[model samples]
Target chain A: MTTADARESTPSSKAPRTERGRKTLRKLLDAAAIEFGEKGFHEASITGITRRAGTALGSFYTYFDSKDEIFRALVDDLSGKVREAARDALQSELPALETERAALAGFLSFAREHKEIYRIIDECEFVDPQSFRHHYETTARRIHERLEEGMNRGELREGLGEAHAWAIMGMNVFLGLRYAVWSEEAAPEEVAELANSILRDGIAPRSSNKG
Target chain B: MTTADARESTPSSKAPRTERGRKTLRKLLDAAAIEFGEKGFHEASITGITRRAGTALGSFYTYFDSKDEIFRALVDDLSGKVREAARDALQSELPALETERAALAGFLSFAREHKEIYRIIDECEFVDPQSFRHHYETTARRIHERLEEGMNRGELREGLGEAHAWAIMGMNVFLGLRYAVWSEEAAPEEVAELANSILRDGIAPRSSNKG
Candidate 1:
């Protein structure tokens, strides 16, 4: 993620004014992800995060006030990164179903590289409940928007709504957990295609009545 | 759940011997769910569970040696209950897709009643990582087995396997999180049918080419 992304993660008052400050803020948040991801919320410390970032304690204080502050910020930062990863994956114009496939593939790839993301985001449920809710709500909203676009284009089924979006999000999240974080037996693209197939045609036998 | 289920949750040596003992054990576990669910693992205390159970501290010890032991048993007990809920929902023979719908509806109903369950299970990732992994892995395995059965019966598509099961599980789980735990905007059957529709026909437009 870039320093620009880092700026959005921090509270405006504490956000970096200089480019160097933004870099340090980004470093601290990235370090916080590793620290919290490895040691968990309670065991993770400001000193540990600073040490990992190779930044001074003063630098950490400039961006974040405490470990809780940094942990919350890290979750927000990671959420933004997740969105960026999917956005980057779909730079090309693709069919509606292919867009979902690309999005899942991007997520799985990101999860494989940053496995700690699961731990950090999961822990946010306890550490900062609001951020935890915000992450999923925002994600589901994005998926819902995509579904609406696909429907409007006469590509996806009509009457799709928030529930379908949540279902798709859940499928992507769990697939990443199983294949990307828990094990690497399946490649990201392979896992994504498998999921996309469900959205494309589902599991019902071809000859079965739609009813 | 029956006393037999409670018996399996605890260590064999610690298993309740008499009817009264089993009842007390179930009480303790039920109370522990509320304690952990409301206060979380770190903050939940043995006394809190015992108090919620309306049993003496000695009775709590009779079934569990420590808070950690009781918490672990609670996760196991809840996992079993989840299976029972799905199984109970399918008392009569159902088409493969209908079976999936019933299971999702049952889970949604169970989740709505035991809202604390998500917190407990999610917290297991931190308090007891093994049980957390065991919960999802076991659930996925059950789903995979069902998919295999459906394929053999010529119901679901032939290539359906573990990935499909995981996808369905993810869909049900996130739908539950959105509609059950977070808000009760939708009925359990209503939510379940929406997911079942996805599995039955997918999100592709009715006239869209399958490719």
Candidate 2:
């Protein structure tokens, strides 16, 4: 198969036509995460992914054509999982600040469970620059949308725009890197509260209202 | 020379005892930054760095025994430069919030001027993980100290700690990535002001003081 055959492997494309096919595909991606995370992109091999997945070599070819294809696919898969994890935490009619807190808490938990996610996505920078940029840009856009919703509801300050969203995204990402991936000294709830408070009351002294 | 010889090359160690030696070392490091930033760690070669520095190959081996050693040194150099940029932006006795703004603005300007910095520092994660961790840990410690100073002076809130410092650092870094490195559509002062306002009043609406 040509390298272009890998394009059909993504869920958005051909995907797996049968339920069994879908299950096999899921196993393949999960195995790919471990393989790439442990060995990094250069050292990771397609055979390693299939072996970890407990699938035949033909099954691997039925989906991805090469290591690069599966790595890109895995990045997109993790990106979606990050969004889903956050979405699962939110309830309708929650306060703007509370929404952010829940999302971050959920994300931190997800990050801890899948610490390998960080290594894979970071490695994507060298393996697939386009996917790396797309993941962050898309994530930041989601954040910006939430900020706008809060503004329209009269919950947040006016003029909370793209830069504010990017700032908050940065805060969440770095907090995860330090607290979740690096170590577990701090609880996810505690770390989320710290970030949430920044959005709610900021770091200014309470009694001193200079304005 | 043995691999151990590279250990003496750090500025804290041998550090090129003479003025001419120091200048040559600086040129070598600056060239390494560009080479690593452009070609990345794996593709980047020691010869590539020396050629870019316009120095002889002997000079390369004089300071670093291998490409990995020079890459580690380069990460340290960039990390120090980040600290200096923020320090140069500050005037003694500035307000706590203003200090953060000045530091961020300085960082944004630095990122803009040395757009290669992000790639080089990021690649350090794969090439030299210890230096990568050290760079961030050191930066967060510096920011944490500043926050404590603010609290002591009654210029900021109480209970602001390492997590908060990490949050602010994340904001500055992502803002720099989006605005300074990726695009220059927004001014550094403008981005700094936006982040400053978040620290000052947060995104909560003005009329809603339910707490």
Q: Residue by residue across A1-211, what tens digits does model 1's lDDT show? A: 3344423566788988899987898888888888998999999999999999999999988887888888878888899989989999999988899999999999999999999999999999998998899889988999999999999999898999999999999999999999999999999999999999999888898665344
- Write candidate 2's Cα lDDT for B47-144 as tens digits: 89999999999998888888988988888778878888998899676999999999999999999999899988888778888887888888999999
Which parts of model 1 have CA positions greater than 4 angstroms off? A1-8, A209-211, B1-7, B209-211
**Model 2 misplaced stretches (Cα beyond 4 Å):** A1-13, A209-211, B1-13, B209-211
Per-residue lDDT for B122-186 in model 1, tens only? 99999899989988988998899989988889889889878888898999889999999999999
Clash-forming residue pairs, model 1: none
Candidate 2 chain B minimal-lDDT segment of 10 residues: B1-10
Question: Which candidate number maximizes DockQ?
Answer: 1
Report residue A1 deviation for candidate 2 (angstroms).
Answer: 23
lDDT of 2 by residue, A121-156 (tens): 888888999888888898898889999998989889
